[model samples]
Target: MRRPNIVWISTHDINPDLGCYAGVWPGAEYARTPNLDALARRGVRFDNAFAAAPICAPARSAIITGCFPTSIGTMHMRSKAVPPPDVRLLPEIMRAAGYYCTNNWFTDFQVDLPEIVFDDCSPEAHWRNRPTAETPFFAMFHGMATHESQLYLDDDAFAAATAHVAEADRHLPADAPLPPYYPDDEVFRTAWARYSDLITEMDHWVGGLVAELEEDGVLENTIVVFWSDHGKGMPRAKRWPNEAGLREPLIVSWPDRLPTGAGVTDLVHTMDLAPTMLALAGLEVPEAMQGVALFGGEGALRPQPNEFTFGGRDRQGEADDRSRTVRDPRFRYIRNYFPDKPAMIHTEYPDRLPTWAAFRRLASDECQQRARGELPSAMTAAQRAVVAQSKPSEELYDILADPHETVNLAAEPAHLDDLERLRAALDSWILEYGDLGAIPESDLEERWRPGGRRPATEPPEVALEAGVLSLRATTPGTLLGWTPDEPASAAEPSSFQSEIGLPAPDGRSWNLYTGPVAVGQPIWVKAWRIGFAPSDDIPVRVPVPV
Candidate 1:
């Protein structure tokens, strides 16, 4: 039997709010996620899937590498740098295993992906573009309609923005229940309604992709997976380390090789997806990957049923905060590295929301009244907690009892044992991963930036012999490529770019150059180590005949 092709559809910031998850507020039917609902009924739904990090770039980096972002020095929100040279991405592994891979234009990869990793990586990237019909493929489609920015639209603007949505989907019922942290007002309700509409829109995109698979007659042979990058995109959700930030919806369907309609309640992290994909493709999971495969052949790594899943938070955009969390099924423990920093880390994106504006006004009003020696009675304890600058270093929550994470059980005597246990687990995880949060953010920046003082990759040695050019690097697995040194105004053709691999079958690290070139032509060659910066370009002139 042929290997199954894999299709991963990922969305932005949506938690398990789908109708199939059975956790949607007001009514499950209101979610209008018929496509995903049907997928859940036809596939395996993971009840306890979580992200290694709550924010986008870090979470995505963890998923793609099968390693904790902290371990790979990609814990920051927008590091805009590639992982260190030692780390290998899932696509690279899959490509090496003879699978065609494509990322549909959304790689918020904190780490850089080499050009060799994917056959295509544009908005139009798809499995259909593979070189041949017999080739197995892995493709990822990222949808952004349900992103947090969708909720930033005010009531009047939301109506205009979502005017394309059916009127029935445009508004939520007046009695819709909201999270206790949010005020029970129209602004909050309207925002929720708009968010729901965005989900519905995202669902439509999912349906379209599924239809395309069926139309291509490859649906049955394709393993379809759907998931979100992280938790919801609200104030206390996206950047926080609570359940609201870490939990994600995950569904996997493979009609030919696996059972359908199965529900997995195992605690699995998003990092597991990479190794799982590798296992599914009959490839060995690299030892450097920290996550287990969850499913595959007997050699696949699987975590225990009650094993704790870990999460971390670090500098997000311009805001700097550090926190780490470890959770089992019943409880979650959080340790804030910067206890003096406020729970609210200001970023320009969320500040645009009307709800966030109102929150800031209320907090400002309460502060002004306090400065005047008057106790503020209008703000609820929950509201004050949202903007409080100082927080306890440790927080323990009985997630089963306090799903919203409003009450801290860290100081409660009744849960002291549980707190200690989780605290130890978190500490062990941090040490095991070599949590990058231990380093100051400014220092990390200096170490990771393009010209920063990080580890250096020695440039390839270029030598011309017997009318041919040879390139070799001391760095094992360095990827070498070259282009002609043409005039600045000249357009370089695609043929000018070529990858040079190892020359001899027994040789360890040498690219026996292949060239029979015209005289007087100049060429520039460069080498790249996955986790380190590309080496300086070396210009070599095609020698004139003696």
Candidate 2:
């Protein structure tokens, strides 16, 4: 079979609360996801997919690079880390293989990137923009409608955001399912309802995209992947390195080749997405990428199936904590580097949520009641964990027995073997990967950017000889980008252009410069090294044949 076009639809802050996974996960009854459910029926559903980190930037970094956040120094939220010398993003790899790759704007990869890594990386980017009908394309559409910000908006704003949700699909605050660890209150309930409405809205958006692919007559020739960045955006879920935080819903559908109506419970990490995309495109998986291909048919570069998946967390907004986790099919073990810090430590962003405000109020009330010698406080043990002053150094949970992970069995003698096994696994991973989070942020910053100055790529040197164009960059690891199209103001250069005699970099039209191009017209070229400023655009005038 020919290589299939890949279209990935990524949504923000969602869990497996869909109709197709009704019996497999919680809150399915509350989800109105007919579009996703229909897609799932024609595809394979992953029941145990987890992200490298619970937060967006880190998790997205892992997905784009096919390496763990810690492995690449992108473990901390919004932290800019120099990629290891050998790293290349997934889209770049695919672009090298002649795939027309595009990302619909959202690129919270935590690390800086070359402007031409994707053929198009704008809100208007689409597979239809590819140069030819024969070209296989890789397109990513990001859904921010389901992001955490939606849940915290004021009533007026929230209503406006979810106004598209049908009345039947809309969830009532009272109908929201309560997590055992969360306080049962109107604040949490309202947030939960808003989250559900957002999910439904995002599902509708997905359906629209899928319909577009079908209408274009390429649905059968394409592999459609749907996944969320992480789990729910509620407290203890968005940033915490727990199952509720890291587990994500993944569904892959290819009507022409793969089996339909299938569900796989095999452990899969979101990092694997990069390699999987390469494998499906008939391209070799890079050795630098740590994650193995999960699917690619025979002769594909898939590694031995993983027995355990790992997760990590570092600084997030105002909260600074270090935690790493390893999970097998039945048990999950967590090691907290900062045992003195509470799990619910205040963060500037989440603090704005009404649910967080309610949590603070309830915790304060509980503390006062306890100080007054009130016996049997109304708060449940699970709820009290939210206000605990500190966390244990280690935690072990039997996932099968306690899906919510409310009960920690780290100190239990009976589960000592499981705890020790997972502990050793996590330790080995940390030792092999080298956690950059272990270094102080200030120290890491100094190492990555000396004198606190971000680096810039040197401009690309160009040559035009015998109707062929070639370019090179002085920077050792810089990626080159070029476009043959004339500049927007080429007919009349701008004031800045007149001074420099070169057009400003029009980033949207750039293509990864993999090789020499047959020159017939003027070309604009630039260079960029990851985590560095792009070089100024340089015009390359075509030479007349002697």
Per-candidate TM equals: 0.85, 0.93
With candidate 2 superimposed using the best TM-score fit, by how many Å does residue 245's alpha carbon deviate from the native? 0.4
Q: For model 1, which pairs clash?
A: 82-111, 82-112, 84-531, 85-531
Model 1: residues with Cα > 4 Å off, grouped in runs: 23-29, 154-164, 171-175, 298-306, 368-375, 448-473, 480-526, 536-546
Instruction: Using TM-score, give the best candidate's number.
Output: 2
lDDT of each: 0.75, 0.83
Task: List model 2 lDDT by residue over 317-343, tens digit each.
Answer: 769999999999899899999999998
Looking at model 2, residue 53 earns an lDDT score of 93
Best by lDDT: 2
Stretches off by above 4 angstroms in model 2 are: 298-304, 376-378, 485-508
